[model samples]
Structures are given as structure tokens and as C-alpha cells.
Target: MSQYVEQGYTAFADHYGSSEIIFGQFRRSRQNTQRIVGATKWCVFRPTNPTRVVVEAAVQERLDRMQTDCIDLLQFHWQDYNDKGYLTALRHLQDLQQEGRITTLGLCNFDAIRTDEICCQLGPGSIVSNQVQFSLIDTRPLHGMADVCQRHNVRLLTYGTLCGGFLADQWLGQPEPDAYSGRLTPSQRKYLDMIVKAWGDWTLFQSLLVVLRQIGDRHGGVSIANVATRWVLDYPCVGAVIIGARLGVSEHRGDNSRVFTFQLTQEDNAAIDAVLEQSNGRHLITAIGDCGAEYR
Candidate 1:
């Protein structure tokens, strides 16, 4: 946490259960001199009536857990679109925000249509950002989310940008692993399904890795992961790419920092587009649905 602060990373995203640990680390880092923006999610998967009391308690719970008076950002996630309770929840969250309990409000895994609806109903600037799955493999955001976000002034905080590390050099020439192989992490299994089922076959994925490697080589031998991340960051609407880290177990800060040092040239983009044009990327919007439809 101190090292990341030193590197000018002030924003930290976490879930409710683990938010306090991150907040504690941020509080201790650099004697609290640096400004820390802690963002956490409140996932309501089940149906519920979001009364004022209900919403207040939920926000207060986060405040108590993080030991903070006000939340830097609170991102809400809803599972069932049929249920209108999410709007009620967001209204109360907005109320809390106006009361100064929340600094900013955002959404998690929301589709473009609903995001537009929320922003329109809540009035412009009510929603600041939306966290969604976006990468070279999953370009659903480009289908409509990007346009909606641009129209509403909402930034995209993207995850799955590395496809759970499948975009890295270690997997460049590796054979497809069994999903049932207990060795793979949960994220690996999830993204592996997207690759073999929704995105393309393993052979096509290897082609992508090869092109990424070639591009990285052009950029002074940066890793395939660097090129992959740079591609996502290059998008205009992308505010930040949320890369997963194992913390003390392993860190890629050095390699990740390389993404900012170089830019992809026209030839590099053309080479990558050649491989992507042959894959199922365009069809994924239909197969998997937009933005967060897979979860629904």
C-alpha cells in the first residue's frame, strides 16, 4: 500500500468485507499525507425494499467498518432488472450523497440502457462511473456502453482487462487447461469459459497472444500484459483498468508501469485488428449480451 501510494496510486477499490483493511493501510501510508479515494461496492443480489432506514443502515455499516465519517465512493450492484427496488436504493443513496455521507456514487455491472435511464431519471451527474468487464476479448462496452457513458459523462472502470491473466506471456504458447483442473483460480476458470465458449477457440486466442507479444516486442520488449492493458487504457471513456493483484504473494507494478511509457502505433493496431477481425469478438455482444448480461 505504501509503495502504491509512493507510485501515485490514491484510489483503491474493494468490497464490503475487505474495505477496512485497505482503508487501514491507506490511513497508515505516508502518515496519511496523501489523499486516498477508497471505493467499495454494495451488492444487492436478492430482492428487497430499499427504504430510507434500510439504505441508511447499509451506508452506516460501511462507515463503521471503514472507520470513516464519509465514503469516498459507493458503487451499487443489482442482479435482477425486473425488480424496481434498485432505483429506490439509488434514490436513497443519492439522498445520502447529498447529505455528505458519500463523496461520489457509481454503479457495478449495469447495462448501457439502464445506466442511461438511471442518469436521466436521477438527473445528469447523479452517476459518475460504471464498473464493467471490458478487454480485447470482451468488447461489449463498445457496442453501446461507451456511447451512453460519453453522453452521460460517466467514466468506465474496467475489469477483466487481462482476461484473468490469460493475456500474459506465460499463456502465450500453453495448451488449453481443463476447467475442472483444481489448479486454476476462480477468475481463470471464469475467463477461460469466455475464451473457449463465447470469445473464440484456444487456437484463435493463441493468435491474439502472438500478436500482442509482437507488439510488446516493438515497444522495447514490454510484456504481453503491458500491451493488453495499454489497449484498454487507450480507449477514451476508460477512467481506469482494475487489474487484480495477489498483494504480497506477487506484484506486477514494475511491468504494469511500462504501459504508460509507450503508445501503440498505427501498424501495431492494424496487426492486432487483423487477428481480432478473424475472432468472435463482434459476435460476443449477441452471444453474451451487453456489458453485464452474463450475470443476469
Candidate 2:
């Protein structure tokens, strides 16, 4: 984010995990977002503990460090699905909203099943969005995630749309990743390797890249990353794709922005699937594991 600030892009960081764990450079990040993005807040996470006061005070302490009167986006990072209290958290969040401390509410890493439960439990207010992984490589959200958001009137803010920078021109025609390319963590590499196999092997991915290159040609130049993002945008209720900013590295501001310019044709969409449909079904839900579960 410091590098993002240097590059003059508005830098807002999402804070997740337990209240006791520090997520980001809270104070400085808040100041930077405010300066660059017009009004911004340091995002705060919901706690695992059921004590409403502890969670409320934790959020308040984050607000105090941010030097902001209100948080712009506060998200429950995950639902305690088998827990003693989900409403206990929501009631306090509703309280915070009524108190004007939190301007917007969101959920992260939650699937459609739990989203329905949240809507049924709390019946809605201030829930502007839900964050999920939606990429060509990971299509679990399309199965039911999109439908639930439509029902609840909640939007999806996505991550992993670019698959940690693998969906790019740089990777096209490259050697199949070796054992030590740093392309993915060892475990993640195993998972994604299975994903590639599902997408019909290296020979087929190269063909897809050929199609992407042809499509990119029509737009003067576009990244496969853009096509991957376009696939996500086609789904209902997707508000934005939170492309990760590798903070000290150079920026792809232009590449990232071009995603909005070109539209994909039915043929283009079919071309992407032509490769995928013929392939074996590794079914990433099982191969790649659940949301945040792989990391665990």
C-alpha cells in the first residue's frame, strides 16, 4: 500500500482475521486512503469471540488508530457456522451502524449457503457486498453464490480473478511450471496443477492463449487477465474485482483498467469454454479445496 500511495493509486486495505491479530498498517493506511481516494476507512473484521463488547471495542480501537469518525467498509471475514452466536455479532454490528460508526457492512470468504443464513438471521441492513473468489480457474461461486446475492441484494467483491498473477501474457507459451518456479506455494501448486489438467492440459491452455491473443488483437492489446476478469464481471451482482496490489512492485494500472473497455463476444466466451468443456472434471471445489481452506 505504501508503494500504491507512491504510484498515486487509491490504496484501501481490507483488515481480516481475529481482533487480537493486527492485519494491516492501520493508522498509516487510513491516512493514505483518505488522501488518495477521497473519503476512506480502514476495513475492520468480525471477531470469533462472542463477546460483543470485545468485538465492538476492537473495531473502535481500529477506528481510533485510523483517526476516522466512521469506517467506510466493515466486513465479517467469515461466519462461525457451527457456533454459539452469529446474531450476537450482527446485533452489535447493527448497533454500530445505528450509532454511525460503520458506514457499510460486508462479508468475506462466505458461500451462498451461509449468505442465505445471514439474510434469514439478520434480515438485512448496511450489507452492501460479499467478498469471494471468482475466477475462470475457480468457478464455485457461479454454482450458487451469484443467485443468493441477487436474492439478498448484496454485491460480490472478488479476489483471485487473476489467479495470483498467473493469468497473464507473461505466462503464455511458457514451460509448464517446474517444481520450483515460485508460481504457487507447494500445496497450492498441486491444487492449481490439477486445475490446469481440468482445463485440458498444457497443449489446450496454449490453444486458449492463442484465442486470447486473437481477441486481445482486436482491442489493440488486452491481457488474458482482462478476459479472466470479464468472465467474473458477467456474473450477476459482482460489483468489483479486488485485484491484489503487490505493493512494492511496479503497477499494472493501465492493464487493470483496460478490463472495462473491451467487451467479449459470445464466440469469445465460447472459445474459453471450448477448451474447458472437453477436459476432464477435476472439479476445483474438491481439488483446490474450499475458500481459505487451502491456506489452512
Candidate 3:
């Protein structure tokens, strides 16, 4: 994000697990700090323990860590399926928004039904957005989340659009990854499992990659990742696609910036869809359940 901001590109940083480490990087680049949107998640406020004190402390801690007076977006995550305390947490977040501590309230990995329920409980136009795992391989949001979001005016801030880098040129013709491979990062291992579950085989995925490569060639030779990100960006209610820029380890700012330069044609959609349709005996929409189902 600091690199992107240095190049004058706007970035959003999430305070998920490593709040200090991630937000600390942004703090170092104070010159371009205003270009970044700071987001953080609340994990401990469950049905049994939700309280105003918890929300206030979490928000303050995030503000202190990010070195900001106000959070651009505060996203919440719930673990228990039967938890009803999420409603209380949202109310408190809304209060924080009114108090100028939070600019927007959003959800991470929330299913359609629960999202709708929250909207109703808080009244219309309650949620500003939702962040979820959305990609060609994980179109679960389309099953029902999109419609609910449309009704409630909640846009989807999508992640995993490239399936943890699996949907890139590097993996095009590679052999199926062994589960026990030491080379697989945790993200890669997780998404590879999703591919096997959503589609059926690695060979089929290679075929999809070939189609994406063909599409990329038609679009001035963009990478497979660009095509994948572009496809998700084009999905209904998708406000943005989150791509991981491994900071100093590697950078794709130049390639990623190209996603906005071209649009996918009808033919491009058809070619990609054809390969996906024949996978796993069903469309990704139904192959995976609604948004957040994988966690449930």
C-alpha cells in the first residue's frame, strides 16, 4: 500500500490479524498516508459478549494502531452461525459512525440472510459494503448475496478474486499441487482446495487458464491475474477487487493498474463461462453455497 501510495495510487489496508505490522507500514509513509483507507475487523464481540465497551475499545485500539483519528471503514466478522449479537455490534458501530470514529460500517464473509436481517434490524441503508471471497472460482455471492446487497444498497468489496494467486500465469501449466508441498503458502493451499471443491480437477483448471490466456492476449497481453480481477470487478455490486501486493517482496502495481484500461467483451465472458460451466457438474454459483457458507 505504501508503494501504491508512493506511485499516487489509492489503497485500502485491512487490520485483520497483523494490525500493527500492516498499519505500521502505512504510518512510515506519512507523506502519502491520506491516500489510504484504513479498515479493521472486530472478532470477539459475539452474541453472548457483545457490548458497547468492547466496540469502543476495539475502535480506539484500531485508531491508535493505524495512527488515524477516524477509520474509513469498520468491518465486522462473526464466527458462530447462531450468534444474534452481531445486531448489537452493528448498532454500536452505527453509534461510532455518528460519533465520527467510523466512516462506514461493513461486513466480512457475511451470508445473504444474515446481512438482510441486519439491514432490516438497523432499518434500510444500514450497511455500506461487504467484503467477501469473490472470484471466477468462488461466485457464491451471486447465488443470493448480490440481490440482498442490491436491495440494501451494500456494495461488495471483493477479495480472493485470483484464488490466492492460483489464477495467474505462473500456475497455468503447472502440475496439480500436492497438499503437503512445502512450497505452498497458506493462502495458496487454501485456495487450491477451493479450486478442487468448486471445479473438479487441475487439468480442467489448466483449460480455464488457457482460455484466460487467450483473453489476455486479446487485451494487449494482460496477465491472467488481470483478467481474473477484471472479471470480478465487472460482477454486479462489486465496488472493488482486493489484490495482495507483497510489499517489498514483489510488486504488480504496473500490471494491476492496467485492469481499468480495458473492458471484457461479451465473447470474452462466453469463453470463460464455457470452461467454468463444464466444471464440477454445476456453476460456481451453486457449487459453493451463498456468501460466507464456506465458513459456516
Candidate 4:
């Protein structure tokens, strides 16, 4: 945490764990010298009535867990679109925001339709961001979410930008790993399925790695992961890319920092698009449903 703060990274997102542990470590590391932006998610997967009391309690729980009077950003995640309780929850959250309990409100894994509807119902600036899966392999956001975000001024916090590390140089010329093998991490399994069944086959994915590698070489031998991240960050609607890291176990602070050193050229984009044009990138919106459809 101290190293991250030293590197000028202030934003931290937490969910489904001991937020107090993380928040306390952050505070101690920061030493109150720099502002730490803490973002957390409240996921309501099951159908339930979100009464005023229920919603307020939920917000208060997060505040208490984080040891803060107000949450920097509270992202809501709803599993079922059939239920209208999410709207009620958001309304309560908005009321809490008005009362200064939350600085900003956002959504998690919401499809473009709901995102548009919520923004319209809540009015402009009610929602500030949406977290979703977006990468060269999964370009579902481009189908509709990007347009809705642009219309409503909602930035996208993208995950899967590195395709579970498959976009790295280590996988450049490697053969596909067995899905059932115990070696693959959970994220690797999920994204590997997306690549083979939804996005493209292994051969096609190798082609993408080749293109990314070439682009990396052109940009002063940056890693393939750097090129992949740079592609997602280049999008106008993307506010940040959420790259998973194992704190103390492994870190990519130096490699990731290189993503900001250079911009992809029109030629670089063309090369990437050429490979993407042959894949099922466009059909993923329907194949996997919308941005958060997989979870639903």
C-alpha cells in the first residue's frame, strides 16, 4: 500500500472481504499525507425488498467497515433485472449521497439498457461510473455501453483488460492450456473459455498476441501486457482499468506504469483491429449477453 501511494496511485477498490483490514492498512501507509480514494461494492444478488431502512443500513455497514464517515465511491451490483428493488436501493443511496454519506455513486456489471434507464430516471450526474469487463477480446462495451456512458457522462471502470494475463509475453508463442488442468487460475479459466468458445479459437488468440507483441516492440520493447492495457486505456469512456494484483506476492507497478509512456498510433490500432475483425468480438455482446450478463 505504501509503495502504491508512493507511485502516485491513490484509488483503491475493495469488495467481498475485510474492507477494514484493507482500509486500515491504506490509512497507515498513506500517513494522511495524500488523499486515498476508497471504492467498494454492495452486491444484491437475490430478490429482496430494498426498503429505506434496509438500504440505509447497507450504506452504514460499508461506512463502518471502512472506518470512514463517508464512502468515496459506492458501486451497486444487482443480479436480477426482473426485480425492481435495485431502483429503490439506488434511490436510497442517492438520498444518502445527498446527506453526505457517499461522495459518488456507481454501478457494477449493469447492461447498457439498465444503465441508460437508471441515469434517465435518476437524472444527469446521479450515476458517475460503471464497472464492466472490457478488453481486446471482450469488446462488448463498444456495442452499446460506450454510447450510453457518453450520453450520461458515466466513465467505465474496466476489468479483464489483460485477459487474465493471456495477453502477456509469456503466452506469445505458447500452446493452449488444458481447461481442466489444475494449473489455471479461476480468472484464467473464465477468460480462456471466452477466448475459445466465444471470442475466437486458440489459433486466432495467438494471432492477437503476435500483434500485441509487435506493437510492444514498436513502443521500445514494452511488454505485451503493457500494450494490452494501453489499448483499453485509450478508450475515451474508460476512467480506469482494474488490473488484479497479488499484493506482496507479485506486483507489476513498473510494467504497468509504462502503459502511460506512449500512445498507440493509428497504424497500431489498425493492426490490432485487423486481427479483431476476424474474431467473434462483435458477437460477444449477444453470445454472453450484455456487459454484466454472464453474472446474471
Candidate 5:
């Protein structure tokens, strides 16, 4: 946390069960607090009603946890799309924002149509960003969500860009593991399943890795992860890509720096798009349904 903020990378932390550590870190340093952006989610696990009272309490708890006057971005997440309470919750959040309790408002895993409805209900420019699963493997956002966000001027904050580290060379040319093999971590297994289901066969994925390596070699041997991150970074409507940092456990500062060192060429884009064109099609998007369909 200290190293990253010191490196001029603005920290974005969420309030959850273990948020105390994050808040503690910032509380220890006013400078750190100033350098970080705090975001929290509502309706994490189906709040009974998501009423204004529930929304206010949740926001207040988050504020008290982070010990900040206002949250940088309050992202809302609701599992049941049919539940109308989500709009009411956002309205309360908007009221809180007016009272200076929130700096900005955002949505997490919201599909295009719903986001459009929310924008219409809130008038305009109500959402600054929509956090979503967006990557080479999960291009579902481009189907309609990207257009909706663009129409509403809502930027995209993406995740799963590295596909839980599967995009790296470490997994290139490797055989698919047995389900009970226990070789992959939970995250790796989850994203690998995405590859098998949403992406195509391992053979086609390896082809992508090969092309990424070729592009990297042209630009001074950047890692496959760097290429993956750079690819998503170049996508339209993306404001930021959330890379997980295992603070005090592991860090990728050096590898992450490569993302800024170079740019992808049109040739590189065409090569990637060619493989993508072959691996999957609108079918993948159909299977995924929409940006946040899995969660619902």
C-alpha cells in the first residue's frame, strides 16, 4: 500500500469484511488517506429491502469504517434484477452525495439496459463509472453495455483482465488440469473455467499467447500479462483496470510497469482480433447474457 501510493499510483480500496486493515493503513497516515480513493458496495448479499434506512446505515457504516467524511465512489450491486429497490437505494445515495457524504456514484456488474434505466431515472450523468468484468475472455461489455455507458458518459472500470493470471506465459501450452488435480488456485480455476466455457480450446488460447509473445518480443520482451493488460487498457470506454495486489504477500510492481512502457501496434491489434474472431463469437456474449448476468 505504501509503496504503491508512493509510486504515484492512486490506491482504490473497497469496504468489506476485512476493510479495517485498509482503513487502518490510511488512518495511520493522513497522506495515505489523501492519496487513496475509497469505494464501497451496497446490496452485497441481498439486503432484506434495500430501503433508504438500510442504504443510509450501510453508507454511514462505510464512512465510519474508513473514517472519511465522504466516499470517493459508492458502487451499488444488487443480485435480483427484478428488485425495484435498487433505484430507491441509489436515490438515497444521491441524496447523501448532495449532503457531501459521497463524492461520486457508480454501479458494479450492472447490465446495459438497467444502467440505461438508472441513468434515465436519475436524469443524466448520475453514474461516473460502472465496474464490470471486461477482458479478452469477457468481451461481453462491448455487446451493449459499452454503448449504454458511452451514451450516458459512464466510464468502465474493468476487472478479470489477466483472467486470474491465466493470461501469463506460465500457463501457455499447458494441458488442461483435472478438476480434482488441485494444482490451480481458486481464482485460476474459476477463470480457467471461463476459458473453457467462454473462450475456446486451450489450443486456440495458446495461439493467443504465442501472438502476444510475438508482440511483446517486438517491444523488448514484455510479459504476456503486460500484453493482456495493455489490450484491455486500449479498449474503448475503459477508465481503469483493477489489478489485484496481494499486499504484504506478493507484488508485481516491475511487471506492471511494463504496461506503460510501450503501445500496441495496429498489426498487434489485428493479430489479436484474428485469434479472438476464431476462438469465439457473439455466442460467447450470448452465453454470458450481459455484463453482470452471472451475478444475477
Candidate 6:
């Protein structure tokens, strides 16, 4: 559920910085305003593979647009597995850290194997997070990522936790769209359709909704996206879920924060487990290709 726009990195960063000023306009119009959430950094992961000097300049530019003196977390967008000079990029970031320009380092869309390689090579010079997609539907990380992060002490930042709003109750009883709206990319819709089919059609999805609603009612009203995000938060090394804000289009801040409001009970967990039992794993673990596979 990550967006890859090669040309406007600087502008995008600036727009997001200024987004807070205008969020209210849209929140009132289209978004749900029941959730309370907090400040989170949106790290850009790219394979422009800029030279260290260019990257350093670009990072500075982003900081300027963001109007922030320090980036709480700066995550590299992608890695060129064959080229292997990301070490140089990490070194540059480490130098920035010494200057107090960046507070923490992170990696986006990188697999466990490459993450270990980087850690072994750099010995922890500002690295702290590894952001990747992790859904109940796509539990590939459980195959090895959890153990790797434990050993290396790297926090994993999970994105697509809500699968671009496809994992919500809105779709439960509704007729399938000729194509889904509200998604910005074809890839996003593609995954939503995948989830629909994988989750056992519209009918079974309605059943899942009944379960989520029951859980929500017990917890004082949590949305399906909130539930999915909380589930991700329960995973090992998952510091947070990276949900898209879709500035000026929707505002889920309040609903998203219900994650902190109510704790999921053993009964709740068991309830979720019960629904998952009915899951048919037809589309479960095939490769979406690599990490951030949707973007590429």
C-alpha cells in the first residue's frame, strides 16, 4: 500500500508538513473523526540509489520542506540487492546523526536477510526500524522476520496493516464496485480484490464483520481497520502500523487511536482466532514479489 512517485519527493514532503493546517476541511467532509492518534513520520523508500552527496542533499531538502530540524525516523525506500552500495548510504546517514540532523534510521520494504546483512556490516549506526507489509492475510514475516528482528534488536514498522481500507466493514455487505474507489493506485485496488477473494467472498466477509462488530461493541466501538491495525501492533518488534492519512480526503485519526483505548481480551483474541479458522488459505502466501512488492 506504499506509493512510489519518483519526481516529487521534495514537494510531497512539504505538502505533508503543511497538511495539518488543512486536515479539518476534509475530516468534516468525508472522514470519520472518532479516532485519536499521534505524530508519526512517513519515511520515503526509493531505489533512485542516489550518490551519497545527492542523497544527502535530498535529505536536507526534505527536512526543509518538512520544516523540521530533525527527522525522528529516516527510512531508506529500497535496496538494489545486486549493487550493494546501501552501506555507503547508511554511512552517510550515520554522519548525519552525528550532526543531530536525524534521530533514528529505518529501512522500508527490505527483507529479513538483507536487513541482517546491513546490521552485520554497519554495527548499529542509527538503524532502528524496518518497515514492511504485514497482514493477517500475508503472514510471510512470521516465517523468519520475527526471529531475525529479535536477534538484531531492530523494530519492524508494518504498513498496509489495513490493506488500504479494504479490510474494513464498509465492504462487508456492500456490492462489489466495478472497481473500488478511494484507493489512489491500481495496485491498491488489486490487493483489495485479492483480500475479498481470499477472505471467502462477500458472504463470509459479512460473517467476519459480525465478529469484528461484536468485538468492537465489547471494546466500545472499534472499526475493522482499527482491529486489523491493533492485531499488527500485537506482533513482535512491531513498533507501529503505518496507515495512510490520505490528507484532505479522509481522516481516521480518532478511529485509528481506539487501538490504545481498549485492550483486546483473551476472549476477543479467541474470537478472532475462531473466524481465522474458517479461512481458506488459497491466496495466503504466494510472493507479492519482494518487500514493498506492490509499489514496484
**Evaluated with lDDT, which candidate comes out highest?**
4
Pairs of residues at least 3 apart in sequence or in different chains that clash in candidate 2: none
- Give the Å error, residue 97, model 2: 1.3
Model 4, range 120-151, lDDT digits (tens) per residue?
A: 99999999999999999999999999999999
Compared with the true structure, all predictions reach lDDT values of 0.89, 0.66, 0.81, 0.90, 0.82, 0.63
lDDT of 2 at 151: 85
RMSD of 1: 1.4
Ranking by TM-score: 4, 1, 5, 3, 2, 6
Q: Model 1: residues >4 Å from true position, as ranges?
A: 28-30
lDDT: the better of candidates 1 and 2: 1
State, as a TM-score between 0 and 1, how close model 4 is to the true structure: 0.97
Q: Stretches of candidate 4 above 4 Å error?
A: none
Worst 10 residues of 6 by lDDT: 1-10
Give me candidate 2's TM-score against the actual structure: 0.80
RMSD of 5: 1.8
Against the hidden reference, what TM-scores do the models get?
0.96, 0.80, 0.92, 0.97, 0.94, 0.75
lDDT score for residue 200 of model 6: 53
Q: How accurate is candidate 2 locally (lDDT)?
A: 0.66
Per candidate, the number of residue pairs that clash is: 0, 0, 0, 0, 0, 7
Residue range 1-296, candidate 2, lDDT tens digits: 44455544553645433321222344344553355321222233343665778668857866765566677677675444566365577668778878998877777776677777787677755466787777766676766677788888988888877766666787788877764767555544754564566444767666766777777876667888788788789777898788776444746876777788889888888877876665553376666555444443
The most accurate candidate by TM-score is 4
Q: For candidate 2, what's the RMSD? A: 4.5
TM-score of 5: 0.94
lDDT of 6 by residue, 148-246 (tens): 788788887776676667678776577656554653366467665755665456566567667777888787777877777777788777876666656
The 10-residue segment with the lowest total lDDT in model 1: 24-33
